[model samples]
Target: MREAAPPKQLAFDLPLDPRYGREDFLVGPANEAAYGLIEAWPRWPDTVCLITGPSGSGKSHLASIWATRSHAWTVPASEVTADSVTHLVSNGALVIEDIDRPEGREEAALFHLLNLARENGSPVLITAAAPVEALGLVTADLRSRLRLAPGATILPPDDALMRAVLVKLFVDRQLVVDLSVVEAIALRIDRSLARARAVVAELDRDALRRGRRITRPLAMSVLADLGVPDDETDEDDAPA
Candidate 1:
């Protein structure tokens, strides 16, 4: 039997939301350990885990996975309070994202929640842009406690990883993308998974609007419009 052809891409509204999941998140040496930790959450010795990564590194996507898997509740850093912690947790796992931004009161509440979760045997997962040591907290105990939690850092994806991620994004959306087009975008755009995602998303919108496939020409035009310098195009002219 022959393999079936993939489905065609669909036109949809622009996705302002960031994409994250096992399927969309590309694994490379940069993030393999973190990926492993996330996948092995079921076997994690401590219920509490701290995931830290640069912005646009897909922390929220990982949190979504854990939330679904562990029936975890998420409390935005701004909304965290001692009372809210009790209500939000309600015996379920907790995923606290952007912990570094919480105010003093929120910090206090988070500290209390950590202690509560540890005592009750419930798990707590926290994510921040920076490591726990970098987040200056007013409470000594909370800072010390957070420092003790196992930390997972998501390293930035490289050009190859970014290209693969872009290809996957287009594939997921049913968009047709040739390898040349993928390479062009990957080479020219800001070298970050977040930037690659944004570029692909914008190209997807532009392609739908123009009723055209995602070709190198279209990708270049979109990148140019986005103000990304066309240095990659000129690289070929450099003396060997």
Candidate 2:
């Protein structure tokens, strides 16, 4: 049997936030249309858009992209209220994230903001964890209005996409990782792209702690210690 590679010392510094600009977001079958829509926002500034996906599925990243590229302002769902809608609408191009969390005053404010933006021909983007129809809004008008906004859903990234995401993240952090290590990580971790990111972050932390390189054994040890399994097999393909 081939001996496992020695535990290489990973040169890890303090963690950096993952880069999620247009360059970092991989475009595959899963999110190509959503990416395209974001890219086209400048040309269609009057089009109101709604983007929905699971938590950590890059909703805020997309919003940031629009904010930077189109000079749009972003408001958190919790801070919005009827009183503040007019000020937020003044931004002309706006993004509201976590729409599902706002209730009572905040929800009403969001509805009014949407109406005001529409009337003014200002572009607005709303992000949520679920589709508008599933938001469970108490106000019928709010539900009906949201249902009319053009919307897109970002599907979770698949294995190949996850591997690409990890490679890009490590490279952005200036860490040199072997292809075998990348493949091993992509194959072993949970399917969620977000989870893959967290695992790499943890691995980086472990390497920093030990002042060592990241090798198969080191990764396994760190993941196991964190309660992440080390089965070295893709759960999507394994026999039940």
Candidate 3:
């Protein structure tokens, strides 16, 4: 008789739309300043604000909060264009997200948006993974204007923040993990918000595959599969 095929992978994943409610945000020293800036809102020192941080550093989360409060229109940097600048600025508030190294095509458009927002007295929030000077924009006017905007930089997450982020990520995936499991993974993996997201996603997939609840062992196995340091694993797994 032919050998039976192995079991097929299951696809029982739910929509992982992150909770962007003000209450869902876990503020810590790493991002308190940025959070404060977002909360400041209409009282901002200028019409434009720049929030810079590493990927998964909650830039978008804060922006979402601001958008909700200010009724701002949101658009990615790549999608911005000279033609859309007028329409985007008319919204009274706007968020231009992920202004990473640009191709210069949108430089004129962004510069125009900034000018229009300033003229119309509308508030604009711009987020980026790097500083304005590092975005590689070829337009000097845009570069200078972006530099003038009051900016808040979010530092990497601390231990407490890391643990909280892990919990939130698990919650986002609708996975109910114990504090022990969350703490174990938080202490073992790299202290990065991006890494936290990746770990949670991987754990969710692994748990779905095994049809088991998220446990310490399952988290450990998923971390190892994700190439987390073996020494880190050994230290965490050791008896107290």
Candidate 4:
């Protein structure tokens, strides 16, 4: 008789690290254009700024930095309402996130807020995975206004960006990993900001459990466990 192994239990130690300021943002060729725009501040070409990119591409990170520096009141679409937007706008700047759909009353409210912000000379920042035209917003006027908004699309990270991101992630966690360890995993990671965070969290937990500093071999094992391809696979399975 054989017994099946139980699944590994996951830890829920979500430590809050207050290090997501502008200094934490890594600049690279892929995102330098967007960074340039963010750095422009209130002098941007338009009153509204849209940041679009693929998931885990650092759009949200850049948006957060801008929000902090601008002191903009950032809110998710779910929290926005016809009543709340006025106060939010009156106080200062504003940001609306998660505009996946414009079916709710919030969409109309966002439209009102945008128009209001434009008239009042306040800049609005938005983040979305899809382009402005592809959102299929229910409100026609909001769509038109968004069309006029000046924004930037962040591209996928190149090798330099990946290295910087991986190294930064480790530093954020206060890990003592070396550059070689970072290099080995950065090239093998799934190439998404989301994946980078997940792998780093897992590695931190695993290293703590094993009472070891993160090393190249440990990074490889973590990548392997996460189903990321190994360097050996390219040669091991190559055509002979």
- Quick one: best lDDT, which candidate? 3
Q: After superposition, which runs of candidate 4 have C-alpha atoms over 4 Å from their true positions?
A: 1-12, 101-105, 231-240
How does model 2 score by TM-score? 0.85
Model 3 TM-score?
Answer: 0.90
TM-score of each: 0.84, 0.85, 0.90, 0.85
The per-prediction tally of clashing pairs is 1, 6, 0, 1
- Tens digits of per-residue lDDT, candidate 2, 1-240, equal 999755646555655866657777787767777787788876763457888888877788888888888788887887778778888888778888888874543667777887888898889888999988788788888898878777779897887788888888777767787777787777777767678778888877777667676786777777788777776664433689
Relative to the true structure, candidate 4 has a C-alpha RMSD (angstroms) of 5.2
Residue 156, model 1: lDDT of 80
Among all windows of 10 consecutive residues in model 3, the one with the lowest summed lDDT is 229-238
Each candidate: RMSD to true structure?
Answer: 6.6, 5.0, 3.5, 5.2
Instruction: Please list the residue runs of candidate 2 whose C-alpha ends up more than 4 Å from where it truly belongs after superposition.
Output: 1-15, 43-46, 103-105, 233-240
| Clash pairs detected, candidate 1 | 9-174
Error of 1 at 191 (Å): 2.2
- Candidates ranked by lDDT, best first? 3, 4, 1, 2
Q: Tell me the tens digit of each residue's lDDT in model 3 across 167-213.
A: 87887767898898988887788878988888888788887787788
lDDT of 1 by residue, 1-240 (tens): 999655555667755554555566668876777777788887887868888888878788888877778888877776778668777667578888888774544777887788788777888888898987788777898888888888689888877788788888788778888788887787887768778777878888888777778887888899999999888654433588
Q: Which stretches of candidate 1 lie over 4 Å from their true place?
A: 1-13, 16-21, 103-105, 233-240
The alpha-carbon lDDT assigned to residue 147 of candidate 2 equals: 85
